[model samples]
Target: MGSMAFSKGDRVVWNTPQGRTEGTVVERRTSDFQLDGQKFTASEEEPAYVVESASSSKRAAHKESTLTRRS
Candidate 1:
């Protein structure tokens, strides 16, 4: 991956099985943690983002590679 170019509250979009989903970056996960019983490993070099879905209002964690900054 490249560098961590996103910050909290940034609007971003990502692809899902249903379609493209838009959301706001809620947090940057730089350490390993568990969400909904699933374990996630994050680091300063390859951080994951916690985003809140615009439509569903649900939160999900995604790697930086899966997200795109919304314009």
Candidate 2:
């Protein structure tokens, strides 16, 4: 795979099963449950991404393929 152009604090958009949601990158993780000492299990094949909503300030974690950098 290519080096995904994403980092913490980056504004982004993603497609969930429900709909598209916009947010900022709150985290990037490998195949582990512990990120920055907190437990968050996600794999590289299905890595977990943490984001905070642009409108609501709510946060959520999701898969990489579901996310895209905001233009």
Candidate 3:
């Protein structure tokens, strides 16, 4: 069986052009993708992670490589 380590609602940290920000996984797609704003797209090649900043409710997409699991 595959491990469902990260699913929707999971809190994670991802590196952005500005810096690392915290957010939540909003959706899961067969192909990774980014939501609104930002130019970068999300995919396994550049797996996308939807995160909402802890400081602000603002959300953004980030590459999985840039994201880290948070407790």
Candidate with best lDDT: 1
Global local distance difference test of model 3: 0.64
Error of 2 at 11 (Å): 1.3
For each candidate, what TM-score against the reference?
0.92, 0.69, 0.60
User: lDDT of candidate 2 vs native?
Assistant: 0.76
Candidate 3 worst ten-residue window by lDDT: 37-46
Instruction: Give the winner by lDDT: 1 or 2.
Output: 1
Candidate 2 lDDT by residue in tens digits, 38-60: 67677756678888888788777
Q: Which candidate is the best by TM-score?
A: 1
lDDT of 3 by residue, 1-71 (tens): 12323578888877767886777876544464436744655454444556678878887665555667788
Which residue pairs does candidate 1 place in steric collision?
none
Off by over 4 Å in 2: 31-40
lDDT of each: 0.92, 0.76, 0.64
Spell out the clash pairs found in candidate 3. Answer: 23-51, 23-52, 32-42, 43-47
Relative to the true structure, candidate 3 reaches a TM of 0.60
